[model samples]
Target: MFFFFVGGVEQQVRQVLKYGAGRCITCGSKADLVEYEKVLKAFFVPVWRWPGKEQLLHCNDCNLFFPPQLSADRTTTAVADQPDVLRCRFCKEAVEPEFRFCPFCGSSLS
Candidate 1:
């Protein structure tokens, strides 16, 4: 019975790591998962489901954690980011949300 419960909980944790809030960007196990906003010199930071709080790494024998590079790619594999629809902050023209600058005017969005 205990084993079954542990297995289920681990499965849920794995799913969260894959689809829910990010696991440790460094390691893949359960992270500190802190929630806070960041401000950096007029940079419009992308709002994540859970932000701030430094990412904590989980090592082997602690929690099964995947590397940041691999995990990040897998996490977004199932979903596509929304199209950009904000005007270029510098150029003042309609631009895709994902772009870093205005395609028409070539002004930096950041």
Candidate 2:
């Protein structure tokens, strides 16, 4: 008897706690406060999901994930102030100030 198995671990965004209007640390684009889940998949189907408690800073442009607590002051202030907001033409989502591209939809902001 022979058996074939495919398994992998995937990190998925569960929810957005807050949307920060600031530049991403990795790509200098927009980022958000996101809750994440770690999923275990086998044979292309999810077997288990582990939801995370703490919110993370996720960069839509570069796909960077880091603890928001690391930059709590900056992110909190940015979310509160929301200076120089720009809207994406394609997705109509809010873009970060001074960004050359829309982080949510990858559209040209210029």
TM-score of 2: 0.54
Report the poorest 10 consecutive residues by lDDT, candidate 1: 5-14
Candidate 2 least-lDDT 10 residues:
69-78
* Model 1 Cα lDDT, one tens digit per residue, 32-65: 3222333332233322232334332233334433
Residue pairs with backbone atoms closer than 3 Å in model 2 (clashes)? none
lDDT of each: 0.38, 0.71
Candidate 1 stretches with Cα past 4 Å from truth are: 1-85
Among these predictions, the greatest TM-score belongs to 2
Per-residue lDDT value at 106 in model 1:
56
Q: Please report the candidate that would top lDDT against the real structure.
A: 2
lDDT per residue (tens digit) for residues 1-110 in model 2: 99998999887889888887344654556778899998999998999999977778888877777775443333354554754666665544567778998776476888
Kindly provide the TM-score of model 1 when superposed on the true structure, using C-alpha atoms: 0.22
Against the hidden reference, what TM-scores do the models get? 0.22, 0.54
For residue 83, model 2's alpha carbon misses the true position, in angstroms, by 26
